[model samples]
Target: MEKRNDPQLRLGEEFFNQPCLSLAKAFLGKVLVRRYADGTELRGRIVETEAYLGGEDRASHSAGGKRTERNTAMFMKPGTIYVFPIYGILLCMNVSSEGEGAAVLLRSLEPLRGQTLMRELRAARRKEGAPQLKDKDLSNGPAKLCQALNILRCFDRRDLASDPDMWMEREPDTNPAEPHDIVSAPRVGVESHGEWAEKPWRFYLRGNPCVSVVNKDAERQSGSVTDNVRSLTCAV
Candidate 1:
């Protein structure tokens, strides 16, 4: 993948917060701008997010006394990236560290960068009988978001507050949508928890098409993206 022509933004402490779920909700409809030092800007509208707390949140990777080199960043300061692969696909992107060791799982994004490249990527997914892209389709699911942005495991645990290579920026022109306009749904996968899995923490913009429609579109069976988009660690 080629480096994007985006300019870099100065990340700050205010971007970091404890108990990242509230911040995740607040992040909705907000622009997460990324600018490379070269001066180009790439933007995305956050659409879906989930919260995870250390050793407490049963649904979290760090839950139930689990810890490893992979989850170490979840115990660091706020504003760190926690990226990993799942199901031999989908490079899930997470925001690590909030109040002791809580994290926000970045489930999906509405892309705003590398327009041509993003479209091409989406086109490949579409020809496979998957969802198509307009502007909003550029980045929806976690893996897709990273794909559109050229994000990788190298970004994992990087201090977003200090890293010039990658950091989130605020867009002054964000239009806040009403809470009622927000849609709440059970998270995708992770259904084995029985009742706890039904919590509505997973959120997305009600009308955004960048969101992954696996469950919603499974009946039609028209959505099929490349299971192995990219993930050096994922087995082939």
Candidate 2:
């Protein structure tokens, strides 16, 4: 693949209008850009994501067609931002996809720019005595990435395609990842969702150190797991 010099190619609704599972996989290698009010910019390469199917997906917040103020963004048009809180203080970000109530969770990102600002933002959220975060740990998890990027709950329902403060972009200069370079696995947490807990909805760049939690078994069975996800998509 030939590299282009353009860096302003933001991902639009069309790019995000794919099915949740496809969007999750496609997000890998894309660039996530966040701009601060102070005119600072933070960019990270999306390294990990998890797909949540629509109402039929038991593990999803919108399961059983339930809708609430918190998850309303999931029902919005593709490219809408869904920011929600976890553990009371931490926030996680997701992007609504083509499904009725489906979305893709950004699990982790590899810092690509503004590392100094990312470190400062992350450290400000931690206790004063906590040890400094390593470079790879800067955005290695959902909440961690949100913190490092300063993503707030107020960003919920915002349009990613038009949001000036935060949006996803594609780097023309970077080669797109091959299928073998990505891995599929079961999502983290939500173990009580019965069979849903075992469904392979999570995806990440294979061997990327920025990934939050790597399931070695899932990596070993990635081919079969990918097939399973494909079958599930067909069944739906």
Candidate 3:
């Protein structure tokens, strides 16, 4: 398929005006565009996502209809960017959906453009003497993706459809000669939430090397386990 060199088109608010699960599934294969202030652009194809059922999902911050300074964006109109920090340092990106508190978390991306810039940014974040980032590992996680794309706290609550710096674009073609198979599983973490953690809301491209974590066993586990594994892992 020929790369689309024309000006990218941003997904409209109507595109996000749907049920959270539907939006999450539809988001796969779409392209995320991040234009820096210097006219450079970072691009990636959406490969993984997780749906948050707003006021109904225990894992969602908007559960029980509680609104705070951090989650107010989730209550806004569809296509709003709901960015928040996890573990104090990592930033996660979500797109607000039709209903209050409904959002879809962007889990992983297949780097499509500006990989050199992404690598530079990722390397800069590492502690002195830390190993450099691998190409596939650059945007494999929510926070790592955000960092690679230069998305930060300033981007929280931005209107994705209208934002000049960032927006999501539709997949250029649905019938690429080689089509990607869609796969679904429960989201990573949130195992302590009992039944809510069992929701199979995570979706990704089957066999995509860019996919982050795909542990079906852990995905099915009801309790969080303690593992002494060392690994590095991002969003928007």
Which candidate comes out best when scored by TM-score?
A: 2
**Candidate 2, poorest ten consecutive residues by summed lDDT:** 1-10
Candidate 2, residues 1-236, lDDT tens digits: the string is 12222336888879999999999999999999888766678899999999999899999999998999899999999999999999898999999999999999999999988898899999998899899888899999999999999898889999998887888888877887878689888999989999999998999999999999988888878767677888998999
Q: After superposition, which runs of candidate 3 have C-alpha atoms over 4 Å from their true positions?
A: 1-8, 176-180, 216-236
lDDT score for residue 45 of model 3? 88
Worst lDDT run of 10 residues, candidate 3, spans 227-236
Q: In lDDT terms, which candidate is top?
A: 2
Model 1 gets an lDDT of 0.66
| 1-236 per-residue lDDT for model 1 (tens digits) | 34442334333766676466676666677555555566555667787777666676677777776778988778777888888887675577778756655787776777766577666655754557656566765776777777676677877888877776666665555556656445656676769867658766676666677766534432222112222333433765
Q: Per-residue error at 94 for model 3, in Å? A: 0.6
Once model 2 is optimally superposed onto the true structure by TM-score, how far is the C-alpha of residue 79 displaced, in angstroms?
0.4
Better of 1 and 3 by lDDT: 3
Sort by TM-score, best first: what order?
A: 2, 3, 1
Number of the candidate with higher lDDT, 1 or 2: 2
RMSD of 3: 9.1
Listed per model in order, the count of residue pairs whose N, CA or C atoms clash below 3 Å is: 7, 0, 7
lDDT agreement with native, every candidate:
0.66, 0.91, 0.82
Sort by lDDT, best first: what order?
2, 3, 1
TM-score of candidate 2 relative to the true fold:
0.90
